[model samples]
Target: MLNQANHDTDDAAPLDMLEAYFAAHGWEHSRSDEEIVASVKGSWTTYELRALWREEDGVLQLLAFPDIKVTDDRRAGVYEAIGLVNEQLWLGHFELWSSSGTLLYRHAALVDGGEEAELSLSAAELIVDSAVDECERFYPVFQFVLWGGKSPKEALAAALIETQGEA
Candidate 1:
């Protein structure tokens, strides 16, 4: 008879399972005792995603950063656009580092109450997929704000356009 106490220790830690999942998917990644770092290439941004296990918070957070450096003059417009962009996001929201002008998207998947023990590779894949999708969809808006000098409304409008034609 297998004791529940014994079974608990024998199970792989949630973070370990996540690392293995990334490896099996052929994603370039490295793991530490605290977090997993991976790079995902998107349509407009190559994101450096950090997966952190917030034990106290009972959630696994994936943060993806686009490589756009906002300059001093464009901070107001960028902040304004992010405010509007975040309002429409379903899963995660974009954030800007005011001190460094770095833009990042953050999403969390809850794994509380021993949920991590049963975490599946498919679930991990889906979380990462969502992060990548958000990055791809919004990178152009950042470009439009910083480079194209578009207003918050215009930048978002241009970014949210749907295309249905052959390349």
Candidate 2:
């Protein structure tokens, strides 16, 4: 458990806690008034994670970009694959930004103001970790659809296959 005392200051902004967590873990990150952008390395790729603190709605939103680019021809397949991937996710959902064709995972935590307004460091860690984990897990599915020329259903099925012991 993180020592809540260190984050109990009344003047602390939500992003402050996140910045602290990133610094403590030695993650390379930059912070603004309402957002923190961090680079997290995972098994498949390094993700660009952005955490935004919306004070008005008391929401902390996280977006993790896997740095995948979906060309116009592959948009339909990627969209279909996103739908299939989202169904397996119990936490965040994957989205393809239409204009940029960037695939990202998004999740949000509602902190609600007052006594519980402050976001805990552990919670911050979990949010970031979950996004990165999902991105890595489903990265191959997207690859199969976009470049391997596999249909959404076929891509999902192939990506979900698990083998027993290492060869």
Candidate number achieving the greatest TM-score relative to the actual structure: 2
Compared with the true structure, all predictions reach lDDT values of: 0.78, 0.86
**Tens digits of lDDT, candidate 1, 37-87:** 987677775788898987776778889888878888898998998998899
TM-score of each: 0.84, 0.88
Model 1 RMSD in angstroms:
5.9
Residue-wise lDDT of candidate 2 within 72-144, one digit each (tens)?
9899899999999999999989999999999999999988674447876667778877898899989999999
Residue 29 in model 2: shift from native, Å?
0.4
Candidate 1: worst-modelled 10 consecutive residues by lDDT: 1-10
As a whole number from 0 to 100, the lDDT of residue 130 in candidate 1 is 81
lDDT of 1 at 77: 92
